[model samples]
Target chain A: LFAATTVMADPLPSWSDTEVKSGIVAFVETVTDPASDDYVTPSDRIAVFDNDGTLWGEQPVYFQFIFAIDRLKTLAEADPSVLSSDVLTAAAAGDMETVLAGGHDALFEILNATHSGMTVDAFQQEVAQWLEDTKHPDTGLPYDEMTYQPMVELLRYLRDEGFKTYIVSGGGIHFMRVFAQEAYGIPPEQVLGTYTNTEYAMVDGEPVISKVPGIAFVDDKEGKPINIERTIGRRPIFAGGNSDGDFAMLEWTTAGKGPRFGLLVHHTDGDREYAYDRESPIGRLVDGLDKGPGLGWTIVDMKQDWQRIYTGQN
Target chain B: LFAATTVMADPLPSWSDTEVKSGIVAFVETVTDPASDDYVTPSDRIAVFDNDGTLWGEQPVYFQFIFAIDRLKTLAEADPSVLSSDVLTAAAAGDMETVLAGGHDALFEILNATHSGMTVDAFQQEVAQWLEDTKHPDTGLPYDEMTYQPMVELLRYLRDEGFKTYIVSGGGIHFMRVFAQEAYGIPPEQVLGTYTNTEYAMVDGEPVISKVPGIAFVDDKEGKPINIERTIGRRPIFAGGNSDGDFAMLEWTTAGKGPRFGLLVHHTDGDREYAYDRESPIGRLVDGLDKGPGLGWTIVDMKQDWQRIYTGQN
Candidate 1:
């Protein structure tokens, strides 16, 4: 009995002993078993994740949006002309209401200003510097520390089982790559996200690859499935998300033949973390809540499902 | 002497014992040796190869271009209307003279007609079917068997030494992916190439991702380095190519700060393989021959440096 207990210890420690936990564990076991009909080969055992709310906290606004705003603020101090538009001005001032009211158009405006027009190396350094210097407004924790403990555990557990984990986020590919390897144990090539056009040039006898302004592809909604197909070239066996933005990824993943798993992280704890679903703007969960269960997707009630939310959480 | 002979039993069997082989062997050993200052971590041991001329034969236009022309001919059997343009007619009629005179614009015309409007899955199937049914005109060998024996050996040698090998080519991603895994032992996600737009939808409760017409990105020349930064994230420690198109890829790769390596495959064997380089329209080696050596790039003279050209060749 003691040997059995030691051998079968919980791989996802932060996840409570619930169906959400059991279902994930069962799915992994079945697919990994060599003699089982559902056994997936190591190469085909790809697992994709939505980053913003699924792996980390995306409250008040998405953490990437906040990063973009802080970048604008920093740039404004160096040159006030960067706040060229009303939206940019509102964004730099940290006025979420005006920026939120402007929707994706407004977000794109500021993202274009702060994210592009520099070498990708330089932009990543800016993100790293900002992450090092700044703290989350509400939590007073560094942004990198906002990753969910159970999700990080889940990522590691899957990798331990010979599954290759990937971060399929709506966040910038370049941005998430800056911390993904450290934060989630997912390397840069495994992180897929929204990306803009880039130009490679030889200047001053040195190679330079710059992030030029212009949208190349948006990795959200239907774009998620398309991008996954484009980059991964294989349908993932497991897919996890937190919002309506991740609906299609879940749909496409579970609809594939053979044993598949879809997980939706429902933010249901106001005290421990956040409790928003139908009404939340940042990580909205409507279709995922309504249609997900019908599609055999597990909706994780964070408050009940998690023994701990973030690492070192009080 | 017996122990060393057994231990170092020439890893690259098809590569003749030339300076090229010695150079490559020394570079790999130094970087992979933990005691060497030039040692790179296993995670950073990325080696990218240009597909057509570098890893396989591309003397009679790119093999992917040949695929496009063959596919159009097959499509014409079903729908004669597919021959809607002069290039399409020339392409279908096997009139290489007219098609060659048309350049890339004409090539794009035929490609856009045959490659798009089908699911990426279906297009890959078409490529697979074509490879099965068709044989190269000059070589009288199956297209998949056209891969260079020496380069394939090199790929395996690198992988055995903990290097993650990738195919960064101007060929169609969809086209190469069908054969790359079997031909070069490189997987789909690691194969980066020219790709077009795609769309996703749910038809009859099934998810479908289809290739749409329009250039999304071209992984050629300057685009090679830019796409590398976008997809792979890490600057590759080694790169190999054969044409002016691959000049930028090798240039950017070797210019990076480290003990880097660049290789050019110059087609010099007219007996065992097609040997035209500077004068040949396909796989032209002018820039690579002219400037590659000046940049410390080792040029592999096919006649002098290869014991085998293609697998099972006479």
Candidate 2:
């Protein structure tokens, strides 16, 4: 009855006819009959997703990067010595020009100052509490509430169909581990991300886990597939991402010797969300889109397929 | 009925009462009831294992390092101008003492000379082919077949219980990718190891992947847990290792909330297999065994627990 109601209320409501029909047909055919050619045992039904712009919006600036900037400003106000005036001013104003001009070397300096020296649990709680009240500059909606509605529906649908879903992102591991569960219904353990070294120490009488700066691993581009294989131990049946960063992930998934699905979300609706690709510094979808047809990837055009952008409004 | 037949046919039938009980209980409890507290939903059931010592024996020497030494000799023999006499002699005698006297800097030189410049696919094929016939100096069995019998049983038991198994080792990722599937039933995609940078090149109009000499990541000690979290999003429900290198993985796994298992295989049987720990250059298991009980870890005493070491005539 729940499935019936979900189908009736939506009835392919926000999806383009082709996108809705193709996705539903493939999933239903795969699960409904064990005798069918498309049949997949539930154990084999695994779906992986990219966070950032794929599941949520990453316009103007990446949400995590934005969080870091805000964190910098807050710390600067408390201790002016934490960051130079130029760095603090640049971060507070959201000036990418001034911030990245220093390149990776400068970026690490800021990151180390702000992200290190805190216990992992304290950092996680800080991120969680910040996310609760933080709103996107343009939309004025809490960042978590700005997640793509259709993608959320798709996630729930896949789970109901017996697919185990995982969030594989390029954000900080402990950072993403903070809120993935409450926001995506994907538990903290199922969220993978870039990480820093964490050391165990005793603070007063209690054991505390402290974060140390420096690169641990980068989970971007080719690293995605490597991480997926390392962590999940199975090639996902379905993989979804929104940029060239995710291209290797889709490539890896489709290369598996079995039925597979790769979906790319194209940011085509400038009205609802910013639309820039190919040359964009963030969420670049060039080679992936050109190669998708050959790779048998399903491209979801956000503007055409989805009537609603974020969930809270819809 | 099938389970009963398997129990009787298992090679290590004379295991100590504690070992037999723990092994059987873990296996049975994990597989029997889908709704039982110990039952892991197939998707959530993931087991990771260390390769060098836990799977195949790493005693006397690490097999890969031996391969590297042999490659160095072959290279010097082919081109005397390429290698220094000191390096060649050390490699020929398998005297790591003289070779590593040069430290990390020298080790890299030997590795680059021996490992780089080959197409990854070609290198993988060579590794696979080598293991097919290469015998361990002590046992004369094909090096690949020298896997510990008790560990092999544990792998099969876990897999049969619906766990997706992975080989997470400090050896080369590309190197282990070649034999992991055939040896452990872990597909190449599920094998996580130390990695060297690889480059894409066009050779005679065909795309070839070639290895480049440099450390990408070393999956040892603390690096093990970090890589696990980076590549595999979830903390493993089960983990197995035979050395101090695997301690961090065991720590991270057991630290996670929920039902988790950590195992350490102690090399205590010199007659059946060379036994040394704490002082051994290979497969040291001292710190783990010392703190294992406090961490709720299961220590497998190889001498008392395993009726067999390797498979077959052993």
Candidate 3:
């Protein structure tokens, strides 16, 4: 019995027995062992991670989109004329409530000013700095540190088992590509997300990638699987996500021919993290939780399965 | 000399000697011979070919768009209600000149009805059959048979040298992905072009890909290199085309490190094929031809370099 426990002991050093045994360790062992029926080859071993809630905290609001709204407010305050003709009228009439209510197009107008014209390196530095200083209002922890510890452990465990991990999210591609490699160890090329138009130009005889304001791609909900197929060209063996936004991607990945795994991180630890599903506007995990059991998906109960919720001192 | 020529004889049996010796043979020998300075590794051997004029004839007009227009006309004639309000209005105006000038938005409305609501396989089969039956109005040969013999030989030769070939074009991705494999021997996965939105659905308990019109991507002019970088990740070592539309692609491909090859097929064989450049609306090889020597690009004079234009016997 002791040997059996040891064999299945928590692989993640920083995590508790319950967290390791139930959440990531058991899943990794079963999926990685060649002797097991669920074994997958390195080439076929692909793991996709959802960004907002699964990787970082998305509590009252999604941080990046909030940043864009804040940017719009600041720009409007500084120079009312700087806002687009439509956004200007909206701002003047206190219509910030419904400014992004026009959906993707409205969101584009907000993000265009917030993100465009910066060099790739400069944009990345700004993101890193913002992450370092910004704290989740609810958690009172740096935004980066608010990432789910159990999920981070799962990411490492998957990588250790030769899985090529990628961040497939509704976040901006260029924005996510900037910090993904350093933050998650997933390379820029592997990070696939929504993208605004970009241009390559010579500035002072040096090549610079410039961000331009135009709709290049939108990787959301149904768009998720399409973007993944268009970019990766291979079906992932394992996919981990916490929201309904990732439901289609999970379905697409698990629908593959061979052994596949889909794990939904249910935010059940309300005290430790925050718990709201289906009704929540951000990171809604309703559809995934509902369909998970019937589809053979592992629904991760954060309260029961994770000993710790955040990195650095919680 | 005879033995060398025999050994170097066109790998594509259908191609003529002038076509083989000048274009295909030179590419193969330069890229495949390890002893040669120009030799490229299998992994590094990336080749890009323009679709419209370079692979299949785009003369008279872009054939795929023409097919869409004809399909639109037939649909309108049969059931007036099938035409969108805008399309019906455009057609009822009875101006071929106005219809042609309506551009992409008008075409999209027409294609949404004609191209959508079918399985990917079914759509591909339809396109393949169309190519087999449809003949160029001027040339009076099947569209597939109207493909340039030298370009076809070059494609096979490059593939034999272990190159991963891609068709980068202004054509629709759905349209090109259909017949490119059967006609050009370039697989659907290897073809990059303009794309419309695709929706995934379960039809009779099985996954089916369906095309919905509305531009998802446009692979033309500056967009060519951006799409290549976004989709392929790897830059090409060799690129071939016959139009100013391909100028940016050739420039971008040649800008990469390592021994690069850029070839522009100049239409100068009027007796055998249409001859036009600079001022010609279709397949204009202007800037590329003028800057070929300066940019170290190889210029192929069709009349001088190709012994045969099309594979079909006239």
Candidate 4:
């Protein structure tokens, strides 16, 4: 009964009493214990989390893509030429079939057009306003509220134990900066992701940084590790991800010479949330799930492991 | 006597009783005082410092360029054909006159050839080993040991007030990361600078990030603010710098809507260190000095402001 009570008090409250949960608890304990040989210093305790499917609902396409489509519509109303581009037209019409058929190049065009050419402040204000007014179509909850409750607990727990948590996502860096601190307690400086090129210029006697229409970097798959190296300069001790897009980050992190933890949030709750793997077009998990055992990465079964998904908090 | 005792207890011991020193202290106090309207939350207290002349010595030439020249010499010994390239030959001969004669393009070629194509770990190991072995020719001290004592105290003071200090420089990001934590208390992750392109690949079933011979980004002049926005996603409240290279950073930082602080480290003690601003080949400070008063930037004169320069800690 005492053991059961203590287990209920686990740092990860939403996580059930499974090997996956215990693994996280044990890893944190060993690395944080001052007397332990595996103890990692506070400065060295960096944990990187993927923000999309891993932390929140990314189904039916990424939240950023939705924001981009909405932005395209707004721009088209003011300047109809924005809709002349095939990709922008397809995106505004909600035709995912056509949008995906054009592939990544088309995606880049749409993203660059929607995400750039504005003052940094104006872009941030627009993103903040959109987040405040919009909701997930399926959940009927504010997009920020769609964040996984278990992952939020994990982030807080790690920070409580002196780890610096960072969101290394594929979303636009500035897009995440809008609500990341309010929603996740991670600062803007700690959020690293795909970037739009920006230029500094004196406009009307005021210094302003304007976003240019191009991708500076893409933080996905193999790009994750490279971007991490470029920005963070230190390899993360803990890597949390949801799909094959994060496989390289986990691989690079776990390969480091130290006690490391790699977690893959497997979507297995079709009733509570959307269950997905392998065949999902958005964030496929085939390669990572197949090699999870070999890589010693914990495969978190959402249906069995999580007691709840969303906790009604931003 | 009481007033003198208070002066002795200054947070910046190396800085004399000057307006520049008082400006820093007053700014910190107001922003940290909870009762003050100017009070900034600890999370928003981001401070960025330039590396070369701001933190350490950059006398004869920038230190990283010296490192590149040394690397070229070593590489040329192994492969004589390395010297066949005009830039490589000039660099290996320690002929700065000839190297600079070829201009910025030649400089980039030399930097790329010397700084890329190795595994990340190997490059870090080489840098670490070089820092351990080499010393500055003029100072007869390890390059890291040549860091300004006044700036180090300022860093500690800011951190003591809950400010997160970051090194924002035009120097090679990886090169600075090798000794940044040891030389100054700033960690690698907190340091932002110019970067070499990198790629993640599986070598012998092990993941490795290899540096590619290309300029990914240059954190100089106009590039500073853009890169800062991309990586940090925050507009810094305090920006410290030493040359025209840091002009854009200072401009962007001071232009923010707040009680912002901008500092320029002006080297004026040629006897103690080296001082050749404006027309100096390295770390020129002309436009910044002319615009300093208008921007309300605090200029620290090494001759009059600092009681001591290098403390030889690193």
Candidate 5:
């Protein structure tokens, strides 16, 4: 009933009546129409999306980094040893300039210091509580409310059409899992992201998966497609992203035989959402902009294509 | 219709109606019954099983090793350089004594030599062809026909009761994925096991995941639960395995909140099937035998409990 009504009316009301929207709708219809030569089985209609810039706003910086910095500040209040190092001190203080100057090492070090040595359950709770208590510095809105309205509609429409949607992000898996279900209607299992090594133990007769200090794997660059293959075990038919980090995933997804769709969310709306692409420190878009159109990918101009940005925003 | 008929009649026909069967049935009923206090939603009804001795027979050496040895022999026959080392030569020649003398390193080396440097699609095809042609030396039955009938029935029953079944194994993931669906009704994404590092490349406008050399991760012991958490993102309500390698998976599963079920398949029928437990070179069963029952795990006596072992054998 939901699918019928949505298909009858505008399936994506937030999406403008443009080539991008039509392209997406047409591709979905062609794959799902059964009679079409490009018809794909329901089980094969897998769609993967990058979380940070594609699903939500990543301007100012990646929100997860903000989460880490804020979390470390509170943690350091109790145990100052968490901020013993100079780089740690700068990151916990929300000094992004200094943190960025120290490069990726400083950024990851800050994350690991605040992220590890806790139970998976406890860390999850921490993320949940932070999402509840915290707000985006610029938007002054809850993190969960920051998800793009049009993308959420797309996710719902795809799911209704018998597609299994997943978030393949560089964000922490445990962290994204905290609110992914409530925010985007994507379940925890379908949310794949960067993960850390965990130790399993019986503590007080209860099974606990403890988060250790170290990176198991980073789900970025080529790691995106590799992790997708390992975890999903199927090449996705549809993929969406907003940065170069997701270039390989989109490339791989669309390169498969038969009907495939790749959508690149170009953050071109400076008034509605901060739009800095090529020079942006986070979610820098380069290769995707250069090569995406040639591969028949639909590049979404956020300023023109989306009627709304946030769920209730215009 | 399948669920209704199975529920009215014997859901598992291969069993001789023992407590082992009753325990599994009762637990499944309690969780799936929506009115019951222990009722779990279908999304949370995740059931994980270890592939090798649990889903299919692993005796006369892990069947995957036989596949590797067999596959290696064929590869070496064409290109003698494929067996560049003494251990490689012995493994290719099916000299288990020499391979065992060299230990896990030799075993893994042989597997890598035959396993890596191929596309995932090609490796899957190789495994599929091998399963099609190869028969058990002792039983003279096709490899796919060696699955336990009672366990397969249990998997079907649980699935009928709204459980999502998964295979967490110590075997090669790509190899087991070849026949898991046809033989055990488990899908590729749901089959987790030892995996190798893979590189994603666009060759001639086609995306290919090449199986590169090097062990990515081994899904055994603690890795079973970790992989479960990573892939499924939920604690399984039920888990089953045959040896000590599955001890941690079962232990961690049964320790979860609310009602849970753990099953250990005790290979005790020496005449019907080769049965070596405590000191067996493969599928060792010491820790599981000692502490499983105390932790409320059901230990299936293959000789007494099962009226039939293989799908059509008694």
Candidate 6:
């Protein structure tokens, strides 16, 4: 009697048979094989991914920006003084251009006013409540549900291959910790992102951590690599990003001495999902797109490389 | 036929049969046993330890201060201009009071001058070199070898019981990352501590993360709990610290909804290791010691509880 071995299907089923998928698979196979020269130990097999556009849909504007807008509207309705903030004023008028022009400093100011002076548990509750209650204006799906199907598969695939997946995003650490585990299977400890200062205090005879105003660090652009080093203390073997914000992360990962992989998820599917690259103010994929090829980076074209835009939306 | 069962000995061999050891064992057993009401799943069984005094000897001064002093002396010898910094001058001259008077701001300034401007790899190498070459002033043992034997056994014991051990220290994050794994079996990612700013850059066509001299975050006092929340996301079930710097961490851990353990390692073995506390300028243990019994926090008296000090010295 002959016995047949159990066979497994493709790990990244949502991804098309494109060079991007092949590159990722090849890198994983090579580094994970015991006999391969580039084989890495399980503990050192770290894969970092940017959260905004790379993991989920960040079209029209970042979801965090939308959260800020919702928060601003509520604050304006309660306290008329909120209408005086420049960014909030632009947001209240429903003008995207003016709000975009205000840059990150304005975003920090808005976050400081709305997100700070509250207990972290309170802020976490607010984020969780908003994520569960609000829907993405464009997709009409919950913000957490808008995560990329192919990328989600990739995250799981990497973990299956002995990689510790981490989300190193420009998003607020506190904000992402609320749903990161539920949405992506990445725990709060593995999620390193932009952080605001917090202070521990005893309020009403109970210990509480209060979020302070002002940004402590921005985990975007060059800051991504810096924060990654500060938090993880090891160079990632695999790095994924969609925009210029992830450029330094990709560069740093690829430039490491041993076998490394850098993947750039180019949003090219306009019909299935929003597609804006190089020219888009939010999640701009300019310098990375232009310089990625020379750096041996895998550029994943979403329209051609991904068969499904999102989970359950295929 | 008679069968003789070889009974295993106590896991924490270095710890004596004192209340401290019994308390630790009881907490671990309760949380680990599935039948117990205090049972915690392995994934959520996180234990955080304060490094300087809690896990090791912090008598003469914090080991990090010793490192900084050594670094300052070398800099002053090489570049006389380094002596211009008041803190560095005081440190180089062996004036502990003047150097201590300068406080954390002065420490940051010295760290910035000596530790900053170098790539993280370079800094790690320097730290490793220092740990290898330098010996504790009075003990004549390698700095890494000066770690508390009882505490080391406790760490291993917890790990064996399925607890994820982490180091939350007031020392520099980079400094602790250098030898944490070797000394305590704690990986770099699990070691959270005071951090300085770092920037990612490409120099000589190679990517490098350059350490910047300003303070990014301090992991002391109120900062401990805040950093723990920021880094770990979940509240620790078990918290170990020696001084008031760890008071907030203990408070935060013990105040969590379910069963939790808080341990304060009181340095009472002056004959074995330095034991000044309460009135001591560094690693002061007054408030925590006074309030610990009422809080149901275990206070480990080193002189009475530990049968050994250092691993080999025993």
Worst lDDT 10-window in candidate 2 chain A = A7-16
In candidate 2, position B193 carries an lDDT of 84
Q: Report the number of clashing residue pairs per model.
A: 0, 3, 0, 0, 0, 1
> What tens digits encode model 2's per-residue C-alpha lDDT throughout B1-314?
78766644443354556754466556557544777766666767778899988888886878888777767777778887666667656766677788767766766677777778887767777777777757788888887788776677777767876778988899888778776766777766578888776654447744345777777677898777766665565678788898999988888787766677888888888998888889987887788979987888888888888777886446
Error of 6 at B109 (Å): 3.6
**How well is each residue in A1-314 modelled by candidate 3, as lDDT tens digits?**
78766664344654555642554556666777989987776766888888888887787777787556555666678887777668645744558567656765666777777777676557667777667666667777766676677667778778878988888888887666655666677766578787777786657744345677776777888777787665554568788788988888888888877777888878877887788888887787778988877888887777877778886554
Q: Which ranges in model 6 have alpha carbons more than 4 Å from their true place?
A: A1-6, B1-9
DockQ of each: 0.80, 0.17, 0.13, 0.88, 0.76, 0.86
lDDT minimum window of 10 residues, candidate 1 chain A: A1-10
State the lDDT at B260 in candidate 4. 93
In model 5, the clashing pairs are none
DockQ of 2: 0.17
Q: What TM-score does candidate 5 reach?
A: 0.96
- Report how closely model 6 matches the true complex, as a DockQ value: 0.86
Q: Can you write out model 1's per-residue Cα lDDT over A1-314, one digit (the tens) per residue?
A: 78766766679999999988999999999999999999999999999999998999998778888888878888899999988889999888878889889987987888899889999999999999989998888888898998999999999999999999998989999999999999999999999999978888878999899988887778999989888887878999999999999999999999999999999999989998888999887888899999999999999999999999886363
Q: Rank the candidates by DockQ, best first.
A: 4, 6, 1, 5, 2, 3
Q: Interface RMSD for each candidate model?
A: 0.8, 5.1, 3.6, 0.9, 1.1, 0.9
Each prediction's whole-model lDDT (CA): 0.89, 0.76, 0.73, 0.89, 0.90, 0.87
TM-score for each candidate, following the candidate numbering? 0.97, 0.79, 0.67, 0.96, 0.96, 0.96
| Docking quality class, candidate 3 | incorrect
Task: Write one digit per residue (lDDT tens) for candidate 5, span A4-114.
Answer: 666476789999999999999999999999899999998899999999999987868888888888888998999998787889998877777888999989977987888
lDDT of 2 by residue, A195-282 (tens): 7766654467443457887766677887777666555545687889999999888877866666788889999999888887898888
Prediction 3 TM-score vs. true = 0.67
Q: Give the winner by TM-score: 2 or 4.
A: 4
TM-score of chain B of each: 0.96, 0.90, 0.86, 0.96, 0.96, 0.96
Sorted into a CAPRI-style docking class, model 1 comes out as: medium
